[model samples]
Target: MATVRTLRISLVCLFCLMFIAGFAYRSLRMTLHSASSGFYLLHSAPHNNSSPASMELELQDLMKVIEWPEPPGPIDYNFSTSPFKTEFHMPFPRATYYVGEYVEFLITARDHHGRLKTYGGDYFQAKLHSPKLKAGVTGSVTDHRNGTYTASFLLLWPGQVEISIRLVHSSEAIAILKDKRETRPDKVYFYGFFDGTNETMECNVELAGPDICKYLDAQTGESWFCKKPKQIPCNAYKGHSAGQSQDILTQKEASFLNKSVKEKLISSKVGTFMVSPKNNTNDRGICSSGLPNPNPSGFYYQDFWQSRVCRNRAFPTPSNVTKCLSGKIIYMFGDSTTYQWWNFLLDLIPSLQRQELHMKYPAPQLAIDPENEFAVQWQAHQRPLTMKYSDKEELHYIANELDRIGGAKEGLVIVINCMAHFISLPIRFYIKRLRSIRESVLRLIKRSPLAKVSIKSGNTGYLYIHGSDWLSLQLDTVMRAMFSGLPVTILDAWQMTSCHYEPHHLHPGPVIVKNEIDLMLSFICPK
Candidate 1:
């Protein structure tokens, strides 16, 4: 009896310890999920040596690469970088340039007071383009950290090309954008509608307190919160919609964002010069996955993107596009940019039919080419989206959707674009979200090594206070860093949009989209 009582007591003590351990683990997971962008959760498996601790360590490494340099002085319009005062000129001017040669420009940043800047933090976009030919290529900008920079362009086309440098943002303006973006999660608001009532309340990713209603995704641990409706219960929340954009910049800060300054082209002394092709035949290797992105990745000549990274194959005709897509299962997930790819295909392929699921605006869509035996689907990635109104049920996290596919099958092509909507959020949130997607991608690849995964880099667009090209560049930097070493194809839309002669747009026009899709197809049909 004494031995039995002792054994029973010992077993009870062991069970209590196990319960306490489990509770601690659960609390830690919840805290991480709620604090960041819900990248890790209590229920998700630890695939391939990836644990919470391991992920945190990896994040720290990425943080170092994306760390932005802070401006040295206080906000003063007189001290801010000025596009009108700034000037760029060819450091080594030549009467004629040959293909495969580089054209370098010396950029001198100046303040509104016409004084040469003594420090560097200003954001400038540089490109070489031929307006008549509709040809352009992004130039590489090298900051000297001493108010001077270098814009280097690789001459890929044989024609007259002009150099352009645009001041996207002054260092002072960027300082304001950075401060508000990190601390002001409520700057961009959303609305929550209550069922059976006309009442709508403000909703957001960071709303907290006892009087708010929270909607949580159990699988992913993602949460959305809204101010509780006075007349309806929290469960009555029926839909989500984008609300007004509240400007946080003061009048003085707005001055830095003036039309004359923001995205304004700087004075250039260089004129358009002719470029002669290389003496020998230039043959680029065939397009394939895992190829490193070349500087200025590709250039436009005759309105076609000539990729330095791959020997791009064109699907110029509708029949050509259909043939390449046949027998393939394509899944595109993210914002409107990814949707544009699907739309482009639908318009291009005459035989492709849209399978109407009665979806709403910015809805998940399905299209099939029955004769070709191929299917394509596009879904908007979850919250931080800026749609005027979208059903909550339609928004799904990219990582969750990737997992549902459960180990990629043959002929599967997954293209992901998640950077545009994430620019307004904190950098850590973007990092965590990308980390989760990276893990999911790894799982898919591990199961089947042949899966073709492509990540579309965010493009240059939006010169406003809310979604600036600088912000897009910042997140794009993090995204590339996070996915480094992975066997994925980066679509290089950043370079594609930056170099294009067309006006900067969040959703680039058909000409640019055509190049983007063609580049994607090159990877799929490299032969």
Candidate 2:
């Protein structure tokens, strides 16, 4: 009897030990998997490490996963003689789609003689608008090259969503599609100090002397210029112009927008308004509750996601703004368009105190609001940038800058956009830069799951010939796809800047900039 009792006790103890061991093993495994998910998603299954050169070769091979839209090749027909006439056909005409369903359409181009142009090199801005909802979403444009193109969209809400289409790129993209020239914009935006006062100027300054470039005369002074001294380079303070705005909508353009004349708007039914409080999954905030542009004027906030915080309010009050940005750290890297976003935030939220850093004028602007406990940093990418930056700013790269900050726990938000400068280079160069940042971002989120990432999509700026809006927008799509796998939220600035009554300006004016910042704020504080 004693021996039997002893065996029973031993068995019970062994069973309890095994159960605890299993639970602990499971717990550790879950933790590790969660930490490494982003890395594995970006990288591949674990295998034997390769040589450094081999590893780079592997990265190059794997990074080829993102399929970039091929720039249009030389077509058999001449665009000058046979300009394209736009037409969009929905995949399911007169159908109602539910939230999260993909909305796709086919766009075909007809030539001057009213014939289907059998070659594709056109770029169109595809958007969904719900005036009542104040929500908009930009669709993907795929050039089929056989004259027809595909515009794809994801239905983000349920309601009466309207489909508005605009031909952002005229037939010009076809000619410059291959041998893109280096035509820069003529409009000059620069900020400089003559003696005491510093201000933003639209400088088209004349050369007064070898050393003195005359900016604005005290009387005729609407703009400012660097007082030319041989030492002071007049062009040094000059900002890169993205070319002039498309002044008047062409007869074809007018036909495309006005239904009575040529174009017609379509209404789509998104079955219901069913946006969650916040979807941290893709970091797309409350998209369901968006209020589309009431006047439905100009390109407004329209993306896969809508702003949770700005549905009813243009911007948070000074007192509440700090609260919205509390405990956040923002990193902005790109050209002036991106810097405009950073500047907008700094100017709008007065409570968010900025600590002046003695860095170059525009490049390394750093500010921290102690009250809100949020920090913002802007770093310019390596040169080919239009604006003349300080020597200190030239050494910066997005990947290295991100490394310097290390990882953050729900505190870091990185915004990357360098498309304007990259227009002259081949798409492959842009792809390489994007892949490098992608790997770094993957490693970052792997170490810190709570960190947030954002990409500002490039738009159809008024770069007439040298830079093709169609090409730029296509590159933007590639960038979006590259970061699609990671936990990044795209701002979809392309549609925001395009589709507006306003000219396709590279540096969008105040109203557009305001909307851009509001959308970003919504992402940071999706209440």
Candidate 3:
């Protein structure tokens, strides 16, 4: 009985030892496997069945994954049966992505065959539809370089988008490529304010070029490039090169002497000039010439004398005039003669008002007041105002400046006058420049959400006495036609100065200046 009991105890002890050994062996094996492999087993099954080839195959399958969601019904249609597939590559791949976001089911298709038809040059139509928005179409293609038919679409709102590309080949065989892409909610970019008061507002559109840098260096003005030279300067002497007189005038001695003489002459005649007084001899009209003659009361002398006299005494106190242009910028672009008109306007206004000045070449006297509500700037090149080169260059500069101002939330009021300087050239050239200026202003207005344009008609007839009547008639015709269908508001200085002529020249005396200012005031500030 004792021997049998001992044998039972030994059998039990042996079984216990085998169980411990088995557990140790299993733990060792697991440690070894973990060291050799790069996976850990937690609550799920171990992933040790994958091979490199299998991984590659999985990636390929992922690339072939259809962008669309699973169809409602199963179908046996094969992609191989499709006639053609259209694809596009974005030159800037990163542009497809925004920071801190991900897009799912982004589809990019390519045609195995490179033959596709196009219309209107190389433009192709791209249609995009979103689940929550109206369908949109690309208006035109920038280029169809080689066989690549590329188009860009912007996802402005978060939703599912369906992309459809159609290659129109002749009247038939319109190839269609369709894909649906899911875009994650992305922050929509809103540029400057679009309020009617702000000038920088623009409708949302897909941009193709480089992002415009808004913060331009203010210290460095526009980089100068040599434009086509002008044949004749606008106010150059008959024999001298067109713009050469500017260089001559720039000399210290000449400029100082000329300015001194002008100031002295103007100051001496300030109080002596008569206002727009009625003629004593006849009731023909008020004269602007101020000189009493045999026909002092006649229409010619009376009107001339009155215009000059009124212009001298018509200075308006700032308090009396409504400050309609207290914070707006008004640009006056033209030649030196235009500068004179601006100066005259400034002088007629109260000195307490703020103003700023800016000048470009040839029109060195240009000035403006940044702080003034009614600031004016003049831009003129040395070339003859009639020359296409001058107008083109001036327009380019104006466009650039307008772009800059448009970026800011400021409205622009432009007044342009150029015909007086260009009168020497063929009428056609003048018309061309005028048209170019008009087009440039129109472009500026289109770009700027808040802009008003006004044009001062040519004052050509006022400068030549003997030919005044004929010149006036011609100017009247041109002014009437030039401003006919346009938005430009005309300021007629020619008729205002019609009767007032310098003793030997056509230059309007002080009286005409007053008449011109009154006309401007009436238009600029009604009532």
Candidate 4:
């Protein structure tokens, strides 16, 4: 009985040992398998290595290289020095050369999975990069399904030129990308009088911009006649002597009246007429005398009457002029020159009403006629006392007023002309004020979606005070710095009126004012 019991105990121990050994072997195998497969032993299967979280790839892998065009001459168009390439993928290369030149580039890229992919395209854009060069050229290739891109560029000038190229690529993931590129070519050319032909003279006198022409006309005291047939001068007055007489009325003074009648007749042909009668004794006689004694031996006065009468044939009146600003809100800011613009606009369009906003000290409010078709509001925030007192306080007041006006929700055409006031100040201080004003204006425009900001560079024609020409120069320099990045249309009034000035002060006369207004309007309503 004792031996049988011992045997049973031994068998139980062996079974226990076998079960322990089996469990140990399975655990060892699982640990080795988990290490090799990069999976946790506690988990059933290996984690996906292709998942975004598991892969450590950069954006460069997905980007493709762009091939650039070759240089025109023996010049070394070094594009390898540019820091535009990606670590993992190649960059889209761009180059600027002449029109008939060939451009070659290599684009090399590798995917995250260690697979290579290549793509290329060619194209060019036309844009002028130099004032001397008249035209520009560029070309590119599209439809890259065939795996090749051919680009070409050509320089118009034969002289020394500088060219810049840019390469760009966009990618959101590995092996997926888009590329875009641009280039600018600058060429040197000489421009001067070619010949004395009428076309060449016309081209030479051709205005840099309409503003320069209008300003010249205005400075020369010419009228800005609107285009209306009824307002135009009669054709008969084109070659008619200013001292000529007419038989329309029977009065000794009728000859003088004919002079006026002649003016009226000429005025009827062209909608507008410039009245700058020359100073001469004949002009007085045309106004005073009626009829001149006819001479049979020398000149036949009756023979001239027939042609004059034929030329005086009248035409039907034309339609009324079209209104420029129907319901638009045109806002003018700055000093007297701005006021000149406001007045010119008001004189041209009766629909415009002159309004004022008085901001006394801390608070400011805008006042305007709601029923008026157009309102010309002027805010001349000049602190004459601030020159002797605290300029900062004055600037604060100006900024507050600008903020209030700029925040208006209406469709606004804001014209700004400011540098004249702060020209005398130190450059730093002037820049500070300009920056503040710019920021305030920008904030206002950003707040108002319908605002179109037009900035007039301070008028050089007029100085703020006597002996302030230096101030105007400083003001321009400061303005250029302040408006570097802002999307403000700069109206160069100073350069426009560089040739002329008012009698004693720098203020431009009515003609310059009109021309400046026309120039401003051209930008406001471009043709």
Strongest candidate by TM-score: 1
List TM-scores for all candidates, in order.
Answer: 0.88, 0.57, 0.36, 0.35
User: For this target, which candidate reaches the highest lDDT against the unseen true structure?
Assistant: 1
Which segments of model 4 are wrong by more than 4 Å?
1-322, 353-372, 382-396, 406-410, 461-466, 500-505
TM-score of 4: 0.35
Q: What is the C-alpha RMSD of each candidate to the true structure, in Å?
A: 11.7, 17.2, 38.9, 39.6
Rate residue 70 of model 2 by lDDT. Answer: 41
**Which digits, one per residue and each the tens of the lDDT, describe model 4 over residues 232-328?**
2211010000011122222432222122211110000112111222332222121011121111001111111101001111111111111334334
**At residue 385, what lDDT does model 1 achieve?**
76
Global lDDT of each candidate: 0.79, 0.52, 0.34, 0.33
Model 1: per-residue Cα lDDT over 309-419, one tens digit each: 878888889888878876677889999888988998899888888876676658778777766667788889988777857765566678877776645346778899998
How do the residues 71-99 of candidate 2 rate in per-residue lDDT, one tens digit apiece? 34433333321223556776565434566
lDDT, candidate 4, equals 0.33
Q: Could you arrange the candidates by TM-score from highest to lowest?
A: 1, 2, 3, 4
The lowest-lDDT stretch of 10 consecutive residues in candidate 4 is: 177-186
lDDT of 3 by residue, 1-527 (tens): 56754544443333334334533553454344331122212112212234557645644443343121222232222211112343443333332333113222211222224334232111133433332333222222334333343454433223344444433221111111011001110111112221122222111111123322121111112211111112421111111112211121224323222222211110011111111222233243322211222211111222322221122222255433326454445566665555666676566555323222222344323333323333445555323332222222122333333333443234346666665543323333344344345445656766773565656555533322112222233434454454556555565454343223332133455555555554444334533
Q: How many backbone clashes does candidate 1 have?
A: 0
